[model samples]
Target: MGATAIVTRFAPSPTGHLHLGHAHSALFAWRRAREAGGRFLLRIEDIDPLRCRPEFTEAILEDLAWLGLDWDGEVRVQSAHLPEYRRALDALAARGLLYPCFCTRADIAREIAAAASAPHGPDGPLYPGTCRRLSAAERAVRLAAGEAHALRLDMAAALALLPAPLSFAEGGTRIACDPAQFGDAVLARKDVPASYHLCVTHDDALQGITLVTRGADLRPATHLHRLLQHLMGWPEPAYAHHPLITDATGRRLAKRDRAATLRDLRAAGRSPAEVRALAGWPD
Candidate 1:
């Protein structure tokens, strides 16, 4: 492939310390941008105020610098950009593609259990269309009562608004999109103003990101993201979903595995070069 001016971003949620898996992802995005002489940007996805912490955000920057990863512009902090996401949500709402969902986790599970067989999606058993069936009066009453609710994309309605056979560029190939599988994915939750799908798609477009590099686990989400981009009339960026780094036991690295954290490895006297090699990136 010829060198193109791509703009890639390493967006990490500040929920925990940086692990080897994070190192590999950050390095993967950084390498792709550096190789093409593109811009590598950093973004802090700290929308979840309950789980995310300022200390972890600072640690992420420190750990990435320690791993010899340097990004190009000022980091885009999602928590600091609420209005942007709100505007995107408002746009979808105005088009009658979004509805307020009042179902709790237990409520959803109960509804799914009542069904003969609940359909499964990328996130798990798809959300049963409980709130989508509510009468306008009932919805208005709940909103008047100040009931906690989430904004979900009415998959069927949103699909009706867009043209069929949505697709996105992946590794120079056009992959067909299947967004209905998500089944009314949440765009804004009661706790967080914006969900991952909403924030990521909005930020990628606003930041002018030309290339999105992440783990293969999130590849399924690209389908929904492509739909969101189309709905909001945002440009679709090329995607590169790399395989996740796994442990000796073949399990993917996670925050619970403290031994795999960069801080632990650094404390064990491992140099940056050694850590980079361990993270599957050798200088």
Candidate 2:
């Protein structure tokens, strides 16, 4: 991976105002691209229609411009690329790696409660895989009845499809992958056409991203992403999961921390340079 053309992206969901934490992540990607004389891109992960807002997207563009971070190429908005994600899901479905899961939150909880033990994962208790055992007739009946359902990856089947010992490059180090830990992760929700894991991997490959830079918090998701890339035959990009920005209290900054927002800081007469420094990226 020496001296390869590095194309990196800073993708943020427009759920709220751009906070300091977002600034740090964006700057991290931007600086890496600039340092290598590569391209920096921006993408809006606005797939969740209920939470995402157009105003927030506009504010993101404005905030990044104010921070003096200019990206190359048109920003890829995930909401606008539903067809691509759909196609990816279709490919996996064709390979028998995906299945329709009709389990609602209440249904899953009921099954988990009935079970003596529930396996835990990084996110939470793993999905009990109740719907994965549904017979063909039962699934057809649910489908015919117009019952809502999400598309879930058959983790065991997917892993079996791939060769043993799947891995990815993390800061030039080869890290082994364990996608099975996610326990049949959702690929596409009933409401949304695709999940974060699906869309991000798809876009990275489509955009030919050579380096994926984001917060270390998403490192766990990388193992699963590696599996998706391998299954989809997408190019594996080098990953650099940077440390997250935190507040004085040692808590990770979030949208709820309005005072740490670029908008709030700008309103308080802080210069762009000052705000950049606050985000831990001083020129």
Candidate 3:
């Protein structure tokens, strides 16, 4: 394929140190961007000022550079780009696509419990849209009064806007996300203005990214991201979700898991290439 402004990014939050899963995700994006003769970029998803640490962000860069990963130009940090996210939020809110949510974590849990079938994954419980019943006028009144609220997308309306087959190219294969499979995703949290789903989609568009490579676990998320791209009037990029590196117990690597963290592995004498190989990444 010709280089159609093919760009890729590795946007990790500075909440913790870099781990195997992150390594795999970064390597795939870096490799594909190079192979396509496109630009590779790094983005710091550090908007969660409460949990994100400056030390951890610094460590992530050190680890990636140690692994021989190089990114182009100045890095993009979500915290540094607040105006952009707020602009998107305002635009969506203006279109009546975003709703103010007053529900807390416990409130969401009560909803899932009431539903009687709780399924847990890497991203946590699926929201049942408990706060969506509020009228747009009511939502505005609460927001104007300074009541803390999150920004959630109107899923039912958003779905109708997507085509039957949401299409993209991945590893030269045509991939499509069935609109029926994705539910409503919160675009921004009250704790911070940016959610992963929202930041990823908006930042990709903002960065002019055309290709994205990450773990297979995010395969499901691609649909929602694509749906969001359509709703937000942003272009969708080609994506490839590679297999995640699991431990001997078959559990996927986590940033907090000491065994899988690059710092821990490097101390144990594993070469950077060995770390990549163990994660099923190309040389």
Highest-scoring model, lDDT? 1
The deviation in Å at residue 239 for candidate 3 is 0.9
What are the per-residue Cα lDDT tens digits for candidate 1 across 1-283? 3455888999999999999999999999999989988899999999999999999999999999999999997998999999989998999999989999998999998999999999999989999899999998999999999999999999999898775789989988999999999999999998999999999999999988999999999999999999999999999899999999998899999887663789999999999999999999999
- TM-score for each model: 0.97, 0.97, 0.88
Extract clashing residue pairs from model 2.
none
Cα RMSD for candidates in order: 1.7, 1.6, 2.8
Supply the global lDDT for candidate 3: 0.81
The lDDT of model 1 is: 0.93
Local distance difference test, each candidate = 0.93, 0.92, 0.81
**How well is each residue in 6-123 modelled by candidate 2, as lDDT tens digits?**
9999999999999899999999999999998999999999999989999999999999999999999899999998998999999999988898998889888888889999997778
Ranking by lDDT: 1, 2, 3
* Colliding residue pairs in candidate 1: none
TM-score of 3: 0.88
| Steric clash pairs (candidate 3) | none
Model 3: worst 10 consecutive residues (lDDT sum): 176-185
Better of 2 and 3 by TM-score: 2
Candidate 3: count of backbone clashes, pairs at least 3 residues apart or interchain: 0
Deviation of model 1 at 10, angstroms: 0.2
